[model samples]
Target: MLGAVVAVNLLDAGYAPYRGLFAVNIALVLGLWLVLPWSRGHRGRRLASPAFLVATFALGLTGSAGTHVPLTLLAIANVAFVFGMRMAAAILAGQAALMSAIPLAVGRPMADVLREVGFLVVFAAFVLGMVASVLRARQLAERVRELTVAQERGRMAAEMHDSIGHHLTVIKMGLENAERFRDRRPEAAWDEVRQAKELTAAALADARRWVRALRPLALDGHLGSAALERLADSFSGTGVAVSFDVTGTERLLGPDTELVLYRVLQEGLTNALRHAGARFVRGSLAFEKGKVVLVVADDGKGHGQGRGFGLSSLAERVEALGGTLSSGNAARGFELRAELPA
Candidate 1:
């Protein structure tokens, strides 16, 4: 807009009388654009911005009725972006005085002096508003980028905890049991050692999945129901009676939805093995009109602690998808429930 306005003023008949000034203005414009744009970064901006203003002031002197006053718009915006609005406002005042001073001292009429100052004020106001809006939008975009990074970090952290942490816990227990029975029950000790070795291999695979930041490979071809059954069966060797049942007709679900169901069961069974000291855990996935609900309930005695990282990750994931997650003591036992759109 400033470029168009400045270009239109070149058509003024009065400026034709001073064609020599046109060449100087052209040189000034070329120099400013080439050597003093704000894209030079802050290191050079301190000196370049002021130099830009000085050249713009010289440009304003080339004509009357403040024909070149709008040229200061770029300099004002640059200073505002680098230094701040307070300094920009001061620069606006100085430009207004300087624009008015030239015409007034040259014996120009009061009307022309006011016109020069008025043009500077109007253009300054416009540039300041534009600069402010641009800054605000930039800040908001940066904030959103930061939040996205943090969310992904939290999700990845949870992935590492659930994917690898659960298996490690079971492996540790199995190893302890193997050591405990090494002398008393030789056959039982060998059996536990074998289970620990199997779990160690599974945990290594999960670690690879965590590094890649994806859903568990076990869910690659299996649907939600099959994945839950496999997860429950894995923990069956730990002396826990695990049961999984799906109500309503089974339907195909998105990968994300299936992953959520599988994670809930994995986390619940893990907590059962680690803290519940219970013998039974039941999981249910219900498909109804427009939505699916997954519930994992264990007959374990409730522990008041709920600060697990996996649960927090699940809460955020569920909330982002406009789903609901609720976990606490249920009528039967401890229950973790999640409902999402199908």
Candidate 2:
């Protein structure tokens, strides 16, 4: 609307009064208004040619001084801002070359005409700087998004391994007991049957916990004492004396941070049960030196039969949160330690 008004006002001023040229300016504004809506949710492509911009500016120069003021700069600025520096510079260079040659071709000196091209070069540089800044910001934001998603996937995988793996280890131990007492010790076989029944109950509980942890809505919330309780309950039937302790004031952490810590603890406990073969598993959380420290230790025989997923998953999860995981023999058994930025 504003461009159309400017076009009409220029025509009314009656300077050079090219009615046909003003009509084209009005059509350009209307055409742009229609085109802009179709470019929604995407970058707009530059379509205005150097010839079009030069012709529009030359036409406006013949209007009244008031109309020429806005038109002269507007055309150059439009081409400079939209199509980029090189194209804008090319347009200015072409205009300068044409203006200088036209006067020379008619046997005249046009030295002052080339000076106008300098202004276009400056405008193009300014627009290029702005475009560069915007592109840099976009790249930084995209990198952050990719890292966030990767952390989330690592957290979910650790959660699945801890819950399911803990129960399966117990079931494997129970079946081993049943096999040892199957023939000669029928009476002892009855005890193994009872252990299998308990293992099955634990497995069912584990399945429920796995489903709950995997739920999208549940994962969004803070993994507070409630999540810790779930870990302790999962180990109840395994005959390991499991203890959980929290010493912090329970401030809320970032979503990704909380999930990572939860998985670290979960996997550590499962590792104690499966690899350490510990009779005592203890978990503690505390705030120390401006950091959150979580430790899971077991008084079990570390380095038992085979490789375990628990400790490996725990390390991956803790590292994802910019934390470290350290494990070794802690006097009587195995220990897993994690430290996360608070």
> All candidates: CA RMSD in angstroms?
12.2, 11.9
Write model 1 residue lDDT over 1-342, tens digit each, in one string.
Answer: 345535655667766666577557656766765766453255754777777766666665565334455566777787777777898899888767765787689989999789767766787788899998988887896796577558767766766687678889998999999999999998999999999999998787556444433445265566668877766666666677989888998788876677667766777777776667778898888989989998889888865767566688778777767788888876766888899898
Question: What's the C-alpha lDDT at position 229 in model 2?
Answer: 56
lDDT values for all models: 0.73, 0.63
Q: Count clashing pairs, candidate 1.
A: 0
lDDT of 1: 0.73
Best by TM-score: 1
Per-model TM against the reference? 0.53, 0.42
Residue lDDT tens for model 2, 1-342? 245455555557564456566557556644553443211133443453334454455544534333442343445555555565565567656755765677578866455444544554565456546645655675686797588567656766676666567767877886787788889887787887787788777677657655544543233352665576566666666667888888867666766666666766766676675457688888898866667888888888765443355556557767877888887777888777888888
